[model samples]
Target chain A: METRVDGRLVRGDQTRRAVLGKAVEIASVDGLEGLSIGRLAKELEISKSGLFAHFGSKEELQLATVRAARRIYVTAVVEPALATAPGFSRVWALSECWLDYSQRRVFPGGCFFAKASHEYGARRGPVRDYLAEVNREWVQLVEQTIGEAISLGELEADPAQLAFELNAYYDSANLASLLHDDDGAIYAQARHSIRARLESAATAGTALPWRSGRSR
Target chain B: METRVDGRLVRGDQTRRAVLGKAVEIASVDGLEGLSIGRLAKELEISKSGLFAHFGSKEELQLATVRAARRIYVTAVVEPALATAPGFSRVWALSECWLDYSQRRVFPGGCFFAKASHEYGARRGPVRDYLAEVNREWVQLVEQTIGEAISLGELEADPAQLAFELNAYYDSANLASLLHDDDGAIYAQARHSIRARLESAATAGTALPWRSGRSR
Candidate 1:
């Protein structure tokens, strides 16, 4: 027997998606705390109570926005890197994709985690806790990717330390680009740092993934 | 003739200093936008009107807070570095003092600029403009210090690029430390990166400032 669709569930899911999309955009500019049901409803031309009904409270809305941002982040940064085979190529792809994601304004305000993490980092609440969790998850992903390259004998370095330095370059470039409004040079600097670190870590006889003429 | 002493003027100045100190502290955690006259008055046990009289408005209050934070920043980071003589010593000292300032929780939240810059980065306002100015002033200072080393023939590197990389490491470590409470390893990692960069930049005949085991 065929099952019938629940129209209410389908409508709620559609509304939830729409609300979250706007939530991430607003949070990108104003911050998660600055995001409000009234403002979001006014912008979306929906009733305040309707938006509140979906989120239940401001904190819930912020949490849902964080989740939505994570999905976008994975699609923009992680999925592209995953398409490359696991090794040095994947690591370089991840860095390039991340810089491109920020430079291309995937979120229209730089990296969502960079903005939101700095926003809630020092404050205490479910929002701050959730952000901290996301940060840990991202760093772990970087470290694991480095570990894969090292295990494959393509690179030889402390995965954790290399991951930390690479990530530092990524975020530093992102903030500098936003702060200075000079995007052209910042990404080039980041790419230089990433290539230098990887070159130092690459094992003997292994091809440098970022060399000028090398094919990945 | 001596100028007439006004108790009200003295009281107002004292109150203004007190208010600004607390404002920077709160803004470090919440943000300049999160700072409100009502909240400041309630927390400081002063009348809202009295605080308003001193600042005149929220915009004025934010401006004053930024100035106050700058003063604290200079004291914590610049003064200590300036105590050392110009050259690689001063440049290294500046980096050490900066890392210590963040690690010691000088602002009780983290680096004040890191928080404030990210907060107003994507938005347009006096606050964002002020932060942008501060960032330029800071980068210029780093470049100037490096230029001193270059002039003395103690180092060989592009000042602008070196400053960018060093500043990147500083901020990356700050964010990582805040995000990972259990990770005391970030500070060490940042120091390693700094030392490596400095070593690579140091002229062959020059002495290494960090080689004396002065301990960063």
Candidate 2:
């Protein structure tokens, strides 16, 4: 699946990559609708016609930017958690990775989806539709992660409800951190909330992943 | 406090009110930064410089829009909740009003603060600072509301934590409803979550307000 692409575009996937890299960061802070090719070209010190050749329209640029952000999001947030064992530990790792991603300013504007989703969540258009789709996929991933824990008998709760709560904590902390100019304590508060919620939901005899090596 | 303003500028104040009314709706969806004097004047069928004279600058326009939004927020969300007796009932009322506000489309873009706060949350500037201040005021209001519950012996959770969780549910439901296009079911889910959280945190023998009219 990785190798499937047009060979003609390969030599200068570099231009597309650079354009998208800047696009994602700007979109993360300003929004897809705010991305102007003229502004981007000015920032990149490139020809407007050259950039125009790649993305025929502003909408295309926004769409491509969203795709680029998804790739970055997967690498920063999903893969690390996937590397952990599936179940409670994986869920825990997923939460930590997400907090770290936002706390570390992976996108200069905090979580790309958090900013973009809120930006596009209200309007009706292709941009908004793509963001909504991405959000659905992300929520499904969280629910599936929780489902793994529930199926393993380590946790017992409604997957959708737990997913919603945990996602809320993740987003709330992100906004709080951003509001406070990168205050790290908000993430700790989220971690505390996540830990408490997990502890309450864990089965009576299930080993706690967070409390490992604390004394069995 | 209401009558302390300049009586000589009442007619000018009316024009300002009219501009801000439309401005809040536009800013709710497009964003505060997206609010331009020319577009606003064109939409209102007035001269750009006339509107410019009222606001003086783009930043001032954004600030006025935020203030206007805060007024609408208070009326739609806070006033109804405050009307109810303070404590768990009021807390529950606040939740209900917020869900109703979002689910009913009180603003064209759903909750204005949710959209605008995320829009400016990352950047450093006066707009961001004012939005942060508004967020602080809001969170403080939630905490103070929860404090009433705790002091009354109706609930016993940490006020800040409880506030964070409830506010999370409210804002989460708002964003979800927006993404889902005015889906009332999401608001119901939020109500369920809020009810359960409050029920869990309530002191023993505290009446569940949500169940007051329903038969056991």
Candidate 3:
């Protein structure tokens, strides 16, 4: 009985991972509400009940999908920036990583949070609450990075205000890139805006984090 | 039969308006995709076929919903702003109107364009194309308003650049307001940022657009 139980648990975990992997992709484009269980099962070639057993309910499945997307988001946007040491360099690194994440199609649709945030921005319940929490966490991470730079005397700016502005540019570029598919130049323009804003706030005696001649 | 024909036509137009009005509210919250005809008909207490007859397909329904939302958007955000003369005041007015539109929940959710833009941002179809056109029209309107200020020698800034920054603050505040419901102060903060940016760009000789000592 123990051997049989172990085998079943392994199979369940495998199915759960597979379901979530596909769920993130679908949600990235069509949104969480759009990622119906029937569609997920059909696409993954699994029994609807099999998928249902993994999450037990549609709400649970949505939550699991969000968790999956969060993992992917961290890997794509946060981890790379974290790999760089904390300070202005990490802050700048995060912006580059984010722009690249959206441009390179990390989820084959663009930034997961941008899509999810818009999808659940109006609605209430667990999904919206989760997304709102994720947003706070992300903003805090950005503010903390900016704070490191400020404490190092490399820049003189309010961390939260600058974080809000930089995040604005990043999201604006993401939406603009999607709106104008033919224009790959919006990303460069966003990068330009970010660089200029940071440079304007950099301390006079501090070294620039980026290459001096880089055109943003 | 002629009397009956007129009655039928009148009934059809009434239903069309009803559907579209509901469509905009639903789309604003759940997105254009989430505004399903079946759900709308059920909610509106009309037969699905009767609702479907007004729009031949879901795509047509979506297109109509977008058009309906656009009209409401103009009424809520642009009309009040445009009531002011086309100069520095108008620019500030536009920002105020936009913030009010989102804060007051014109569609009982938030800015319809912000929600729909993110919804169709990655998707391709007539719906997405139309949204893109509306966005271009909107950004152009902002740019034109700024241009008017520049022409009047009230502002000395690039219309496109100023438009982008102003638009960014508008959206950032909208999203922040939604995510942080308890923090009503975000709107005032957004206004502060907008005023500051505008002041920085305003020509030295121009009258300040906001009230004196309003720069908090």
Candidate 4:
């Protein structure tokens, strides 16, 4: 039996994807508040009505853009690191992938979550709540990764504390790179900080992932 | 004749001070882009023409607001730390004062520079340039403080590297506190990271400032 797909529905999904792709990029540089259906329609050559159909309101569009960005983030940062061997290597890989993601301009404006989170951090709204939830999830993921290293006796430290420090390095590097327009030294500094911090946390007998051949 | 201040000049200066006081608070929360002369004039119960006289353009207003915030930051975070004895105690005091500044909501948000820096980081122009300059100034100050500790044989670490890590912790904690609305634990976590990092760098004979009777 041949399965028939509806072309209109497929087009709708494609349009939504395209809109969100553009939305995330704009929002990364200009903030979510800068997103407008009119601008998107003009830039993308789509009807404003089409965008309205996809997103009932500006907040809805912003929320959808964030979700889209999260998906992109997982693919760019999370999955690559997860593919590595569990334990210290995975943790190191996560940091490398994150730095690469930011350095590579994965969203054309550095880390999407960092920009949006800062923009909405002080505001109380659905967007802020959603970003906070995403942040909590990311922090937990980093903590869990460190917990794996701890379980394997490869690291010795509080998972949450190490996670906090590592995440801070990632964000600080990202912002500095963007602001100072000096991609080279800022990332090198962050890499130095991360490698040194991880070295401190590594157990006495554990092989240092960064010093190993697998290091970035 | 005693130095008599001009009455009209004093009134104009007072108005400028009042406007910027509100501007920094609003910019800290809503971002500099959220600031408008009309909105400020309405909120401050002043004429739009008056704000126009003070700030000929939006960029001028933003620059003034940033300058104002820096003055407040110096008083809140830098001055108190400078009052402490040099070496490890001064470095520790800087961290404590910075955490307190953020936790106390000096700007009714978190760190004013953190929010503003992240807001204008991606954008180019005078504001971004000024922010980058301010950030460099801050990083150098931290580095110089660490150099003092190293000179006193109280700590042993690369000034730039340690400064980057410590600054990262401060910013990460600031953002987390704002987003999570958990001031107490977030600050404790930052303090723990800072103290631990400093402990790692402290010399053998040097007393840890955080462990001393003068510790926060």
Candidate 5:
């Protein structure tokens, strides 16, 4: 059954979602700075005043777009990895899903966070602060996942350092794919790099994550 | 005596240099697309037509800025590394120089190429093509440096793979610096990673590069 809500509220929510969907796609390629309410409104066939009512200012619009991207990022990249068991296997799944998300053009550019982070990382303001917070959230998730493996005795390394390298591989591959016209092999190379790094850190009896379908 | 040049040509050269100098700084903080003739003219207090004549178009201005950045990059990062005797030492020197360049805020952003490349990586245009070329040149130079180390028998590893990982560290550290407010120690951690990786591949009796002040 549909949740009880005013018809006007439902329509407004739908419109907001539609705007953000287009917003994230534009920001992914042209950057958050490139996202303009006027262009977005025209493209969405909505009134500029209508879109402006959803977000009070350009900065607000950018922040909302970042939040929208975060939700998609969670669904496409994070939730699937979290669905797996917590440990090295889950961490491996996270990398795989991230690579898939980028190469599949989930955002029609690449990872939204990577693009926005670089865009705002050098700037100052509420937008930069929010993007940094999102970045911190993502990095912490990666570190925590690695920590699970270390606790399980499946891996041996500093969680922060491994997180850094793993995240680096993800971003490098994302940028490389964009530059190379979504060349599939870049993802493979990233996978190889991830697998090699993980293999180097895996404990002697730990099952390698890449060799799937074998009973532990 | 002043180098002889046509009086009109000298003024033209001076204007072009001044325009490019501001262009690189703005492009660094705001990406190449953020740079516009209007902004350049307003900021430099030059007429719009004057700035427009220097580059002819926004795309040409971006390419000229990239070229200007390249010259700065060569002087700041590449030349210092090249001055050293080639081989493992030069590879080590290149890493140090790159890290230093980023830490020193050579572009007032992070790395110029990193910012511009991420800006245009997904978009198809002369800007993206030029960025890709710059990226290829940087990566190939890195590979050649690694090759020198391998050929000298001081290091043993696949040059391509090593180049990828090393460049990854450089770019990662640069981005992390932006995110972390130029936290000086990220470079140290990246240095540590670079050293550890090199140590793993280094042959017996090869002196560690970091143990400096000892004449080679």
Candidate 6:
């Protein structure tokens, strides 16, 4: 009896994961407001009642989709950057990974947060609050990474200011690429800006990450 | 008969202008997809058939809204910048105008293009095409303004690259301000980055725009 219950729970988890996998892709293309439980159920071949049992409200589903996108973001952009040595190289890695994440269409439509944040930015709600929290978290991470380079004497700048600039490049490239149906030129432009900004801040005699023979 | 017909024509024009004004506001906040003829008619107290006659279709309305937004953008951001001398100060004016446009909430939600572009970016349609065209137009304007500064020998940088970086800062600040509901700190950060970048590119003898006591 215990085994049967455990099996049911695992299956339920699988279904929920699969549903959110589809949900994030849709939300990336369409806004989170475009997410409809009926449509999701129809697309996923799940009964509407089953979806309701999983997510009691549209807000809940939207929140879950955001959470799912966040996990994918961390894996695709954050984890690899963190794997690098904590200094100028790691900062470069973060930029490279982010460009790849957007260019490669990891979220199908583009960066999930870019789309979702603009969608819900003006509206006041749980979704907006959550997205704001996520953005704050991201900015802090970038600032922290830059601080590592500053502390190591490899770079010199205000971490918060530099982080804001780096993030701007990432988002601009993502939007330009998506809007223009670009063929990689936008990402190249973004890379140029990121490298130049980092170079401007790197201390003299410090080995630049992009210029060095080291792979980032 | 001529007088009556002219009066009717003038009234029709007035109604169309009013409808588009409201439409742009709605699109800025809720996105173009959220603009519904029924809702507009109900809110504006016009007959649905009247709106249908004016717009003909949802696509037409969205396209018209975009056009209207472009006009407002030119007035709010472009014209003011163009009024400045065509040099480093013009480029600086452009940045200041754009930041003001977003900061002052000219569209009540934010820069209409920033929000609308992200909304329709991934989707393929006439709306997306129109948005892409507008974005291209805006980028070219920035590039042209930067070229003027470079030609005047007041700045030294790649026009396209500098345009991309400056525009990135404008958009990033707009998004950050909206998401965080900031108290003007985001704009200050963007201003610092913009000034620093331009200062790096400015020729030694060129007078800095922001630093001068000129009323900008």
RMSD of each: 2.3, 2.8, 3.5, 2.0, 2.4, 2.7
Per residue, candidate 6 scores C-alpha lDDT tens digits across A144-174 of: 9999999999999999999999999999999
Find the 10 residues in a row with the least total lDDT in model 1 chain A: A207-216
Name the lDDT value of residue B172 in candidate 6: 99
* Candidates, ranked, TM-score: 4, 6, 5, 1, 2, 3
Top-lDDT structure, candidate number: 6
Q: List the residue pairs that clash in candidate 5.
A: none
Number of residue pairs clashing in candidate 6, backbone atoms closer than 3 angstroms, sequence gap of 3 or more or interchain: 0
Where does candidate 1 stray beyond 4 Å?
A: A1-3, A212-216, B1-5, B213-216
lDDT of 5 by residue, B1-68 (tens): 88777999989999999999999999999889888889989999999998898777888999999999
lDDT of 5 at B138: 89
lDDT of 1 by residue, A51-136 (tens): 89998888888899999999999999999999999989899999999999999988878899999989887877888888888888
Calculate the i-RMS of every candidate, to one decimal place.
1.1, 0.9, 1.0, 0.7, 0.9, 0.5
| Cα lDDT of model 1 by residue, B1-216, tens digit | 899989989998999999999999999999998988899999999999989998788998998999999999999999999899999988899899999999999998899999999988888878888999999999999999999999999999889888988998899889878866735688999999888889888998877787775444
- Model 3 Cα lDDT, one tens digit per residue, B1-216: 354358878888998999999899888888888888889999999999989988899999999999988998889888999999988889999999998888888887788888888888888889999999999999999999999998998888878777877888888888888877846687887788788778878887766767674544
Worst 10 residues of 4 chain B by lDDT: B207-216
CAPRI tier for the interface of model 5: medium
Return the top candidate by DockQ: 6
- Fill in the DockQ of model 2: 0.72
The residue-by-residue lDDT of candidate 2 on A97-141, one tens digit each, is 999999988998888988888888878889889888888899999
- C-alpha lDDT of residue B3 in model 6: 42
Alpha-carbon deviation at A103 in model 4, angstroms: 0.6
Query: Model 2: runs farther than 4 Å from truth?
Result: A1-8, B1-8, B213-215
Model 6 chain B scores worst on lDDT over the 10 consecutive residues at B207-216
CA lDDT of each prediction against the hidden true structure = 0.89, 0.87, 0.87, 0.91, 0.89, 0.94
Question: Which residue pairs collide, candidate 2?
Answer: none
Ranking by lDDT: 6, 4, 1, 5, 2, 3
As for candidate 3, its clashing pairs are: none
Candidate 4 reaches a DockQ of 0.83
TM-score of 1: 0.95
